[model samples]
Target: MITDSENMKQTNANIAEYTVSEISGALKRTVEDRFGYVRVRAELSGVKRVSSGHCYFALKDESSVLDGVMWRGNVSRLSFVPEDGLEVVCSGKLTTYAARSKYQMVVDAMEPAGAGALMALLEERKQKLASEGLFDPSRKVPIPFLPRKIGVVTSPTGAVIRDILHRLSDRFPSNVMVWPVLVQGEGAAEQVSQAIAGFNAMENGRPDLLIVARGGGSIEDLWSFNEEVVVRAVAASQIPLISAVGHETDTTLIDYAADLRAPTPTAAAEKAVPVKVDLEFSLTDLGRRLSVQKTKMLEDRKQAIVALARALPKPKDILGMNSQKLDDLSERLPMALLNSTRQKSILLGRLSGSLSSGKLQQAARFNRERLLSASSRLRPISARLLTEKKDRILVAARMLASLSYQNVLNRGFAMVKNDSGNIVKTHEGLKIGDKGEIVFASGSVAFETSSGMNEATANMPKRTSEKPRPKKPNKVNSKVDTNQGSLF
Candidate 1:
């Protein structure tokens, strides 16, 4: 009975043994149910945000250490980061990581351990970020006079966004993109920073400017804008940013880093754009001034042109001066001609008194007969010289005909040329496929050059197959043969 009892106990213990996953799941459910909303006040350590945007850290005191995680979705609800050594109170469900066989707290909310601690932390961060030049006035971007689109980073359901939209509509209506983010809580700073960066990194149709705004709140309620992440994001933004957190008295770190700061969300909208009515009035005034100035300039130009026209000489006056000079010249022209004719008559009379008319006639007859006899003798001499020159020209013509290329072509010989028009003196430069022309005694033949002397002989059967002979005059007519009809 003792052995059976021990075996039964051992079997019962074995029956209660659980698998790794089962035990993990059971522990997770028990711990979660027991402390579903427990708040842990401890110093944070080993805080790290992963690439996936999930935050993993440890909450520890002197006696205990608890591993904690804030999911990417729930992280946006946090207003401050849990840095190492930072005193914080975190609230969440206790859960287990089944694969690692470990348990951790899934933190959904957090706050600084006390108001004093949060203020001290905020001051320390402000100094650190300032030391890095994040708060330099030189780093601030200039707000555009007119932006096509404006981006708003705020809570979607709050009065802040509605007020900003209404103000923008009243002032200058613009395309407003609302990047909804938690205005306060544990990880709200990260969301705001991410929203800022996302708008900056946009490639297609990004907002021209950004506004980080929120409604009236206490220092704790506005702590998200004071975060290092939020401050750095504002400083590093490519587009100009405006900070409008709470009322005029609620100043945040973002207000310092932004290009412009507003007392309220509505003021931020006003600062972002101009009042439509005021702009219309200014435009109307400018247009009227421009029209008046243009009219004055045109009138001044017209008066100056009239002054210049009056100073210029008249066309009729110029014509009258030219016509009076023409008349004076015409009156002097006849007297000048008469004076010249009288001087010539006096010279003719003096010459007439010096000559004998009968002697001049007799000398003229004698010279005419003598000139007739000499001309008759010179005519026959010129005809005889002409006959001799004709004979000499005939002899030179025959000599030139014998030396010409046409006479050579009349023989059995020929001129061969390549496609480039160079005389083919030898077979040295000939390629097998080279085109060439062969001018024969009768006509010309075009053919491709041969690869070798043997190929040339085989290609031109009648040229090389016949017995070779000394070239003699052929019966074919050439261009030099006038009586012979053209044969070549």
Candidate 2:
């Protein structure tokens, strides 16, 4: 018989050996091969995003849980942020984490599982945005009665856009700019949000009103309008926005955030512009009313003038008394003129009798004698005034002579002036070699300053070699007496 050790050795040799990593790797391949891809419905739990942009979460129902991982690229594509307790359907391939030695669903796409789940998520999101005041009534702007240009955000090939154009053409033709974007699938939310912002950013041909429209559909098909980016963009629009995303019974988050909401795309167009015929009719009616009012006012004024005219007396009756008074004055005028002429004639005769030639000559003699007597009195006063004027003139002449700078020069003083003809009051400004003049009563002398001369000698006149001449007092006195004699 073979020994026990030998049997154990044979058994061990018969089995294949494997390392820890090899086993783990083999298991990962087997799981992937069996279920390459899957769609799992479960409530989200422990949803966390790390700094590296990778999302980690657990999908659990009542009794079991499965781990899920989404790479950075896929995480960025998510329409809504993942949160705990949100029910979602994840579409991904099966994979394994070697480090943890656990299997996980490598999520490429995720969405709310059903209409109920989506509605719940939408309600939660609506509450959150509402709390932040994004849906406040005060935040909404008034829609324009008629927009100059209308910017539309919708699919170019859809019926929604055609309906909007048709309605606008019938109501009021306007400039319409279509920003075509995907309405339903993968990147639809991003495109819709960007379209809203793009219209606001236009510098030229910018729309005064915006209409975000899409045809009616299920919640999943219209979920792009409910995205947070799209909703926030609608709220923050500078131009007024009208959301017409679905049929009358359907609603979306954009309806709450938009400046105004219309049940259908055609309704949005109607709200944007008024009917052309109706506006023309209104203008015509207003014009008619204004004309009627103007005519009525003129007629009332004419009637008032007539009433006032009747209250006054007749023109002929008002002038009758004045006319009679004028007639009476006319009758008395000729006789009064005759009586005045007669009285004037008598007075003239009396005056002429008194005024004879002798009386006239006597009056002339009297006036002549008076004139001679006045002339005799005026001659003495005239002579006295002439004597006083001469005396005053003599005194003024003496004072002027005393005050003259020539008199100061005569007392042995001299004045200095700079080259510029300005009086030199002090020697401080006189530099050596500077040219100037010195003035005395007799004459002036030009000279340059020298270092050898002191300040005291600068203003003094040079001495002459001849004897000094004396002043003639008798000649001045004789001149004064001659002036006095001439005045007399």
For each candidate, give its TM-score against the true structure: 0.52, 0.60
Q: How many backbone clashes does candidate 1 have?
A: 6
Specify the highest-lDDT model's number. Answer: 2
RMSD of 1: 32.2
Scored by TM-score, the top model is 2
Model 2 regions more than 4 Å off: 1-17, 33-39, 45-56, 60-65, 70-84, 91-93, 316-488
lDDT of 2 by residue, 84-125 (tens): 998999999998898998889999999888778889888999
Residue 183 of model 1 has an lDDT of 81
lDDT of 1 by residue, 398-479 (tens): 6545445676788788887888988887555666667766676666766564445435444533557678655432222123
